[model samples]
Target: MSDASARPKKEKERGKGAGAPRVTARRPTLGHKWLRYLQEVRHELSRTQWPSREEWIRATQVVFGLLIAVGIYIFVLDSALSFVIKGVLGFGR
Candidate 1:
């Protein structure tokens, strides 16, 4: 059975000698909703602490440095494995 607390007030009050509550709030239109969403995004972006050019460049360089290191390690590992496999299988190139 569904919990009574999970139901809306109008639904819960059904057959309970209570009237449905009148809604006083109006829903915003689609255009106004989009405008409000964009305004919120702009406000949040303004509040965000952005990284400086030097920090971004240093971070990018570190990422590239690690990328190159990983690539070199993988290449060396693959070469070593290939050499061992070829020797074991008596296959040469």
Candidate 2:
């Protein structure tokens, strides 16, 4: 409940605009922003470490193996549920 907290903070004056219209902050142009983004991307990419061919291949194999195992598990689960539902409803032919 201090007076400082209740009152708004004052902005510092810049370049003799006491009576002049308030000047808005300047923003970078579109081309300048794109160029800066590309520069940052290049900097980050240079710092990245790529895996060896053997390591990459092993990781890819692991991902594919897990995908196949999950597919089989889902198929088995769906088949079992379908069989149970058909038996309960006497819809099996």
Candidate 3:
């Protein structure tokens, strides 16, 4: 069941003799809703499992290495293609 459904309904049943406090539905202003949203985000962030410094460093190194390898491959391919094109056009002679 949803959290809202799990919670007891706030509405008072009729013929219940006790003069319970009347529940007033207060509409939250936009600013108040925004603040509440920020609070929820902060709470969720707190629950996150952050990687250790060593793990972060290792991940960064892997990504950087892959990027460097891909860049070198692209550069070499472009250079080879340009050389082939120039040779075909007799530009180098």
Candidate 4:
């Protein structure tokens, strides 16, 4: 049996007596809820493993290097395609 059911019958009925006000559920206010949410966000951020300065710099360098390499490849491909198209059309004449 549950803990409430285990209680004596007289104790259970005492709160339901004539003078007792019926209990109602209360919702949390907006400001109080926002404060609680901010507290939880701060707690989670504190536990995160942020990257070091050196790691961030290295990652940024790798991204830029790849971008330059891809740009060069596209530039070479476009130049070759233009030359081929020009030759086929006899545009040099």
Candidate 5:
């Protein structure tokens, strides 16, 4: 009874009939599509702002530092947990 319910019936009556077939999209050939995609990728890469060698080296160092820190934290935590588990189960013998 509301406008929302009545709008669909009106739209359906105005649109394609119930028996009309649906239209499908046609894709480009593989070779042409690949060439176009590569060109677009090159264009996008050219527009990108790349980091300098110094900046890249600094970023890599930071990443490695964090990785080592996390590795050490996990190693310590695992060792503690293993010790506790062995003590609780009396398996240290």
Candidate 6:
């Protein structure tokens, strides 16, 4: 390896008194953190492209149709399995 690659990286320096204790990074208060979050949310909201009502309705219908199809498939499979189970267990009686 090269000498540059073998050398260790230097860390960031913190200004503290020579005789005083070292100061660590401080976290923001709850209210200040919430305010900062709201600012970020508003900034993102300004850049969003909202879909039209008709587009939303069409998307909703597509999702609903897929859900209904899946539900019916599960119901049919469950009923078929139940019938098979009953037939197999009936010979014991």
Task: Please identify which of the two predictions, 1 or 5, would achieve the higher lDDT against the true structure.
Answer: 5
Of 4 and 6, the candidate ranking higher by TM-score: 6
Instruction: Give candidate 2's whole-model lDDT.
Output: 0.88
The digit string of per-residue lDDT tens for model 2 on 1-93 reads 999787655543334545666779889999999999999999999999989999999999999999999999999999999999999987877
Candidate that scores best on TM-score: 2
Q: Ranking by TM-score, best first?
A: 2, 5, 6, 3, 1, 4
Clashing pairs in 5: none
Q: Residue 88 error for model 2, in Å?
A: 0.8
Residue 15 in candidate 6, Cα distance off native in Å: 15
Among the numbered candidates, top lDDT falls to 5
Per residue, candidate 6 scores C-alpha lDDT tens digits across 1-93 of: 899876655332233434675579889999999999999999999999999999999999999999999999999999988888889887424
State the lDDT of candidate 1 residue by residue for 35-74, as single tens digits.
9999999999999999999999999999999999999999
lDDT of 4 by residue, 33-92 (tens): 999999999999999999999999999999999999999999999999989988998776
Query: TM-score of model 2 relative to the true fold?
Result: 0.68
User: Across residues 1-93, which tens digit of lDDT does each residue of candidate 3 receive?
Assistant: 799777655444345446767679999999999999999999999999999999999999999999999999999999999899898997776
* Range of the 10 consecutive residues with the lowest summed lDDT in candidate 5: 5-14
Ranking by lDDT: 5, 4, 1, 3, 2, 6
User: How far off is model 3, as Cα RMSD?
Assistant: 9.5
Who is ahead in lDDT, 1 or 6?
1
RMSD of 2: 6.2
Higher-ranked by lDDT: 5 or 6: 5
lDDT of 4 at 28: 92
Each prediction's TM-score versus the true structure: 0.59, 0.68, 0.63, 0.52, 0.67, 0.65
